[model samples]
Target: MEKTLKRLSSIRTESDILREFLAEFLGTLTFVCIGCSANAVMLQMPELSLINGPLSWGLALSVSIYVSGGVSGGHLNPAVSLGLASIGKLQWKKLLHYFLGQYLGAFVGSLLAYAIYNQTIDRMPNDITWPIFGTKSASHINAGSAFLDQIISTMFFLMIICSLTDEDNPMKPSKGLLPFAIGFINFGSMIASFSYNCGGALNPARDLMPRIMTAIFGWKSAPFAYNDYNYFWIPIVACHLGGILGCWIYRLMIGNHWK
Candidate 1:
């Protein structure tokens, strides 16, 4: 325990921060690439169900966690980062670096996915393009409900993540199992978001950055056109709020017991 704390605390050097940023960037890139590419392919196919996107995202994120868990704790999602920081697994001072790396990485990943399937997109009509990249609230669901949907989804996700990574938790899984557990529940979370039509975007970087890419590259109104409200803010803002709440809940329910 002492050695682990020492090593974690020792990462205060400039080079270390830069390395951590790069790891986060690359990890997020890997996650968004595989996850969103799968969504794009499925969206273009038309015959497939929406469930496929969540499956792909969950599996892709599992791989992302495996790839980057060692260096940066595999915080491919901003909500995950916020949860970790809230619980003291991450330092608050370096959050800006992590957020920047994650957003940039997500942007690049969205561009890469677009490039890979741009041929089909260019030939396709504009109407179908938005659903491929950005998410929306279901027509029947109001914007407020959609906002709550995101909060609940991210809140559950972060709590599970905190529990899995908590060293003091008896129910915590081994390192190898952590990714799968997170991935599996992430799949569940996406299914939960289906009713709201937010596509279970528990991560701001995952939702907003790609939405930005779509908006800039001709899909100007796609990201915010859902319902009577601009649905873009729901995932980005609500997820952060939910993430903080989740960690606090975990600390209250389980983490504090160690003391």
Candidate 2:
């Protein structure tokens, strides 16, 4: 009876869940708002993206992680949340809270970006502006190739993320630098694949939510109907699988080897 009562007492309450939800929400919002703002800027000046896109997204992720890492571990992306949960690092029950927070936060963040750039957005062509809110495959790639691209890229991303945050890893960064280190991983990823099959959307919430916003806010169904809707689901579905596989691979290769 004493053990049962102690366990019950230690269980997270509704308030704890709420706090985590709010942290994830705010963190994701910060990430999307800042990252998409950079995308918006690059729409007007395409040449700038070669430098601006990677740097802005990396710093944006770093800042967002710093903002909410204390409260919720700053799994600002659903892929990160799913990966951690799969590895038993996060409670399965908390997946709903994290998903809701991340998706809602991403949607609201897109709205904020829209509010800030509506005038310029209205003047830009749809093709130019839509990518600001969502990813589109480069014409050379088909849906199958794009799907594989997301899987491979996101798999690599989550593998590194698990390494960076693993407490048992000998070379893990200090807590203070973890955010920046993870941010640079993202930066390096973008530099390598930002123009790849689907712009390397490693986070489902980051891609899908903002893509939905583009559909609603004047881009219409073209955002979803692109490539006969075949391309639309690649980022969402592939990232989840990639995240899970990445965590599994990390545990198999490095995490399980830790003493």
Candidate 3:
């Protein structure tokens, strides 16, 4: 009994919690930096076609998950965390800690992207490059359209995530494929909607942190900064809602036998 008690106490130490929290922070920071930095570089590369954006983001996200999944569960997105919590897959006590870590990690990642691209950004004329970094403007989209696009894209993304991670599904084959599945979903969503609306940023971390970085870097001079940027919270909120809805839909359709 004493040995068992010692083992349990060792698992619950402050150091263990801190290590997990730091892992979450670093994992999320790396994900955002790689994914969004790729986007920024793609925008600045005159030789490269804009057509490669979706594939680039998908590759980055996939690689990040493969590298970080063991330590942090690879939940680099707030919506993913919320979805897991809603389904009782995550501990409620850790929710806020995870969220704070994700947000701070993303902010750091965006700042790094800004630094890496600072020279290229300065060289480009404001007219040609501002829109690429900034959020979609009201002039670029209506509130209704933006909201619907976010909801639909997030729903699809969440469904794919839940399905891939569902262990009980005999058809799922193995956990080895989850990273590829997630990457493909991101790729599909970006290809299907990024051109029509910039807010198709299905990952809230991908959108909000970059926007915050943009503001900090004085990209607020960019068109639609104040007008459209104010609507940024909608996508964040909608994505969470869509994730919850997607989980419910998955349970209904797939039948949650795979507890």
Find the candidate with the highest TM-score and give its number: 2
Candidate 1 lDDT tens digits, 1-259: 9999999988765686887788889988988888778977886675665567677888888888898888888898888788778878789987988998899989998889888988888787765676566666766777788888888878888888888888888889999899888888788655545434567788999888988898888877756665544677888898898898888898898888895
Models sorted by TM-score, best on top: 2, 1, 3
lDDT-wise, the better of 1 and 2 is 2
Off by over 4 Å in 2: 1-14
What value of lDDT does candidate 3 attain over all alpha carbons? 0.69
TM-score of each predicted structure versus truth: 0.89, 0.92, 0.83
Native-vs-model 1 lDDT? 0.81
User: Which pairs clash in model 2?
Assistant: none
Best by lDDT: 2
lDDT of 2 by residue, 1-259 (tens): 9999999989775697998999999999999999899999998888998878888888999999999999999999888889889999899999999999999999999889989999999996886788898888887789889988888888889999999888898899999999999999899865346546687688999999999999888999888887788888999999999999999899999999976
Off by over 4 Å in 1: 1-14, 189-196
Worst 10 residues of 2 by lDDT: 188-197
Runs off by more than 4 Å, candidate 3: 1-16, 46-50, 125-134, 137-140, 189-195, 221-230, 257-259
